[model samples]
Target chain A: MDIVIGVDIGGTKTKIGLVDQNGECLEQTFFRTQDFPNLTNYLDQIKITSDELIQKLGKEVNILGCGIGAPNASSKNGTIENASNLVWKESVPIIEKLKERMPMPMRIMNDASAAALGEMLFGGAKNMTDFIVITLGTGFGAGIVANGKLIDGYDGFAGELGHVDMTLGDGRLTGLGVRGGLEAYVSATGLKRTIMYMLSKYMVESRFRDVAYNDLHGEDITKAAEEGDEIALKAFDYTARVMGLALANFTAFTQPEAFILMGGLTNSGKWIMEPLERYFNANLLEVYKGKVKLMYSKMEGKTAAICGAAALIWEIQDKPS
Target chain B: MDIVIGVDIGGTKTKIGLVDQNGECLEQTFFRTQDFPNLTNYLDQIKITSDELIQKLGKEVNILGCGIGAPNASSKNGTIENASNLVWKESVPIIEKLKERMPMPMRIMNDASAAALGEMLFGGAKNMTDFIVITLGTGFGAGIVANGKLIDGYDGFAGELGHVDMTLGDGRLTGLGVRGGLEAYVSATGLKRTIMYMLSKYMVESRFRDVAYNDLHGEDITKAAEEGDEIALKAFDYTARVMGLALANFTAFTQPEAFILMGGLTNSGKWIMEPLERYFNANLLEVYKGKVKLMYSKMEGKTAAICGAAALIWEIQDKPS
Candidate 1:
């Protein structure tokens, strides 16, 4: 049996899995990323865990390659650059270090791009040649596909859609210290800010008024909206308006076939989708009106990230060299 | 000798040139586009004029194919769809009609896309794989190249940067009846509107106040700015500010190596360039701050369009199909 190792590196935890060609995860394990502060030790642990997974299979197996998805990873340089969330704050030469211990053809990309490739390979965008996979988690991120290929851009730093400025000078500041960026108004943190604003602006009764700002979470807002909270619904509407208008502008750039939503914020479901769909179409240019579809990612739960990482290997393998 | 027929179809006139592989025009001629309101007659005139140009060359030349650049033209469908400026109000099946008179491997694309291709084949972007060409004529248009290919989008209707919404709703109305689009702020007509707005808003003394809105042209503003007319200078400042900010947002999309400015408005020279450069760099995300260069088109004067159109044939011929 031939298999590939897929690694998904998060700030707090790291997931590793043995994924076969059919998009099945044969075995999986995780380790605390913060525990291994040193880069070399961290890579060594990945090798050890991957070997343990193969040994547990209890049969003859061939290791094809490895693929990794990480924050701020550059596919061109094969390094992770300025990933502030991680303990290893400097640029990590991940590919160079990993190759010495567990050698095979490997690739690394930003997590959002890996998820897009995952969507193209084994999810809702399987048949789509041109589409965008937007990951709306703690922050906003996008992976663009056009002409049936990922837009790696000149320096492999493309698809930084989160930081794209949404307003001239009068919006919230993003993590990058930029004001009025898309991420400032469209992410999980953005939703919380909106709820806070609504609480102050409107005299309408809402459960959110009782909760402290830092105590609130995206799930709490979603729950409140599910219970017909006015402030929560209004927050979703405001976020949807910003997202829809930004997407309409993005449509002018690539005119993609569809946009697939992914990550934690998508858990809000119809609260976000219904309004986003309506605003997206309403803001589009005349020619692109009613042509683009909006949908949710089909890759479900824990295995999705591992499968996305593994899809990177298949993508490279299938390319005409 | 081998050559291709390059046709540049404008609203009022059409230019035809016999071009060789080296991007040299061997012979050229023109015919009034509005002279014949009928589509068939216009295409017939094109074929006749092209034959006359080839005969004038006075040599045995192998005609490779014909390539056309026109407004609202689709390279995929080989038709001109809803080109309002042209007398033919309906979608014109240009390739199908031209094939009957002059048959060969032909291609057609919108004028901006053709100009970008021309820049790749013959101008400043010859060595660049990723770049954007912005045509600042009476309206704003753009052609984006990423991963060494044109971003034609899913339905071949990509690169409509002109209509990308620049404001939430506070800006001017565009020709498409949309409010606050990039075209409404960054174009020649947009400059006139800006001048008019400046005259009404500020008590600054200027020559522009004497000129009515209908009689104003882009060059008039440029000439006035050259003489240090405060209102005209302010108008250019306002236009440049809008364009620079828009380009900053655009940079986040593809991270192109450069942005080449073309068309009539670029003739404003330092009146636009100096301030545009300052604002563009200031507004760019930190990662892309100093990486992207802004340049003017290397293909100059009337011959630029003809060369751009001819480059299309070479582009198709060179592809590894």
Candidate 2:
């Protein structure tokens, strides 16, 4: 049997797993990302954990490569360059360190791009040559696949769909200091802000009204929307409208076959999906009408992160440098 | 000698030329586009004129192919699908008809895509893999070249950069009926609207105040800006700010090595370019700072259009279908 090691590095936790071609995660473990103050410490931990896995299972299965996904990572040089969420203060040449530990082919890319590769290889977008995968977590991020390959721009920053300015005037201030970006309106943080704005603008009283602005999260709105809370429903509606419109704008540029949605916001299921579909179709150009489909990611929870990491290596292996 | 025939179809004139491998236009001629009210008539005239050119120079040179450029043309199907600017009311199977007459390898591409290929082949972008060519004429159009190829997407409309929504609210209405699109602001037509908006918003007095709205063109503002007219200066400044901001936004997505400007607006020269360069650099992400260059198209006037059309054939000869 052959397998690839998939590693997803988040601010709080890092997940490592062995993934097969069928998109199965055979075995997995986790460690605290914050504990590693620098790249050396992080690589040391990765080495120890991987060695333990190899000792137990490496005898039976051959390891192909290691695929890693981290915030602000560079695929070209395999470096995590100034990821704000990570404790590493400067650029970390993680691939070089990983090579020293295992002497294997290893690559790193932005987490969102990994997720897109995951979808193309194992999830909802297996058949799609041209489509976009948008992840809605604490923030919104996207990966573009055009011509059956990742649209990794010259700087490996091709699919910053959420960063596009959707606001004409004063809107939400993004962490990047730009205002009215789609991420500021569609992500978990953006959803909470929408709830707050709905509370003030419509004076809609519902269960969500009981939640404080700072204390609120994406789950609360999903919970309330399930309970048929008016404010919660309104908030999702607003989020969907903005999401749909942004997808329309995006379609004019790439005319993707579908947009696969992933992340915590997807918990609301049809509540968020229906309006998004309606508005996306409505805003699309007449020529492109009823063409681009909106789909939910088939890869869920830990499966998404693990499969995406494995797919990263599978994707670039055939690419011409 | 080897040559390709280039045909650029515009609203007022149809320019046809013989382009050699060296990017030289050996000979050129024009036909009144208004004279051909139907596709049949247009093709009939094209066949006769081209046959004449072949008879005169066929012995001296080898004509490899014919490349045609027009608005609303689809490269995938080689058809002009309902070009609003053209007299033909339905889809025109242009390549099929042109091939029937010439019996040589022929192709059709969106004019902007042809321009991008032209730049890569003959203009300033020969060595670059990732770059964009923007034609700012009556409308704004873009052609994206990444990974040493065009980003043609699933369909052929991959590089409609001008249609991106720049305004959060109702700013300007595009021909496509979208509001505040980049095309509605940065184009030569958009520049005139900016002037009109400036006149209404600032109530400024300048030479441009006397020109009727219908009579005003982009050159008037360029002429006025040269004379240091306050209103015209403000208009170009405003247009540059919007254009630069849009390019900055585009850079985040593509991270091209440069953006080559073509079409009538380039005639404004440093008046439009200096501000565009200033703002494009200012708004780019920190990593992309000073990386994307702002370049003027090397081909000028009819040369750009003719070379672009010829380059369309040259481009596809080596591409994977």
Candidate 3:
């Protein structure tokens, strides 16, 4: 059997896995990402983790290559450029360093793109040729696949779906200095904004009102909704409605087969999916009505990002070079 | 000297031409499309024209094949289904009909898609791998090319830029019964709407005041703008501002190398391009700030569509089969 190394580099921790073609992680481990503040230190830790995994899997499987998924990582440039959350202040040529050390075929893609590839290779989108995958984390990000190939664009920053402007008026402003961007209404941050607005608008008492504004988090709101809180429920409905309308607009542009959603937001389950389906179908054009499905990522905890990283290698082989 | 036949079928006229590999029309002729009411009559007329053209150029050139560009044409199914402007009420199997009559290699594509092929083959985007060609006529249309191929979705309607929803509120309604679509703000019909709104807002007396509301046209506004009409200038600015912002949103999605503008609106020249460039730059994301260029189509009138039709055959040969 052929095995591949999957690496998911997060702000606080880095997860490494020995993965097979079927998206199964035979063995996996993690290290404290924050412990290594600089680029060299973090890279050294990655090398150590990879070497340990290779030594254990070497006897049973032929190692194919390694796939790394990183935030702000560019596939075309093979560099992680100025990731705000990471300690690396400058662009790190991670792909070059890996190639020099291991001297094998490897690829580094944006985390969202990698997750999309994982969905196509191992999750619900296995049978779909054209689809969209969105990771609604602290910030929203997307990976768009058209006609069975990921859209890398000329400079490799093609799938910036989160930044698409929805309106230009006195709506919410984004980190990118744009007003009413999709991210301003359809992300975890956006959901929190919705929660704040809901709390202010409705006079009804709720558990969310007890928490301070700065202390509130996404999970707290989800928990509140799960516990049958009205304000929280309305917040979730607002987020899902905006997201569904954005998805419907995107559908009009590319007419994807489905939209695979990952990250913390999907944990809301039917709260998100149910309202999303209603708005998506309502806003979709006549020809595309009821055609595209909204699906949640099927990969289990912690493994989802790791599986996506490893799936990148498999996806390269699946597509025509 | 390889030669190909290019056919551009319009609602009123059909232009047929024998084109060379260099995108030069060797010979051309046209016939009134309204002369024939049914698909059979129009197709039979096309066969007759092709025979005549071939007979005229047979001895001097090596004929390759034929290419046809039509409205609401689906390259995937090779059928023209319910084209609103066309007289044919039912779906016409255009490709099959052409194949049976000519017994040669041929392909049919949407008019905008064909025009995009023409631009790539003979215009400013000759070296661009990813770009968009937008035709702003009676209706707005788009042909998206990514990784050096036209994005024909699973159902052959992938690049519907015109129909992309621009707003979620009670904005301009499109002929297709959609609200706030890009076409509702950027096409010839959209321009007329802009003019009417401008006339109502400002108390300025101009040539437009003398003309009846129903008799007003897009050209009247442009001509007035040329003669220094304030309302007309505002109308053009509004159209450009909205279109530029939409292009910026599209840039965030696909991040194409350039946006090539064609059709009647390009005749407005700097009034449109200047504002479009300014707004496109302002609304663009940081990384994509100076990357995507907005270009004008190089293919001249009458010949442009014809060249595009013939270029479809060449495009097929260029791509790996």
The numbered model that scores best in TM-score is 2
Work out how many backbone clashes candidate 2 has: 1
lDDT per residue for candidate 1 within A20-78, as digits (tens), equals 88788889889999899988899999999999988887778888899998866788999
Q: By TM-score, is 2 or 3 better?
A: 2
Q: Write the per-residue lDDT of candidate 3 for residues A72-164, one digit (tens) a residue.
A: 678898987656446775578899987777776788887788988898889888877788888887567788888788888878777777778
Instruction: Estimate every model's Cα lDDT from 0 to 1.
Output: 0.84, 0.79, 0.80
Better structure of 1 and 3 per TM-score: 1
Candidate 1, position B193, lDDT:
90
The TM-score of predicted model 2 comes to 0.91
Full ranking by TM-score: 2, 1, 3
Where does model 1 sit among the CAPRI classes? medium
lDDT tens per residue, model 2, B88-187? 7567888988788789988878778888889989899999988888888777878888778877767776777666777653577777677777788888
Alpha-carbon error at A264 in model 2, in Å?
2.2
For model 1, chain A alone compared with the true chain A gives a TM-score of: 0.89
Q: Which candidate is the best by lDDT?
A: 1
Q: Quote the lDDT for A309 in model 2.
A: 82
Off by over 4 Å in 3: A1-3, A10-14, A29-65, A82-106, A168-170, A314-321, B1-3, B9-16, B27-65, B82-106, B317-321
State fnat for each of the candidate structures.
0.56, 0.54, 0.54
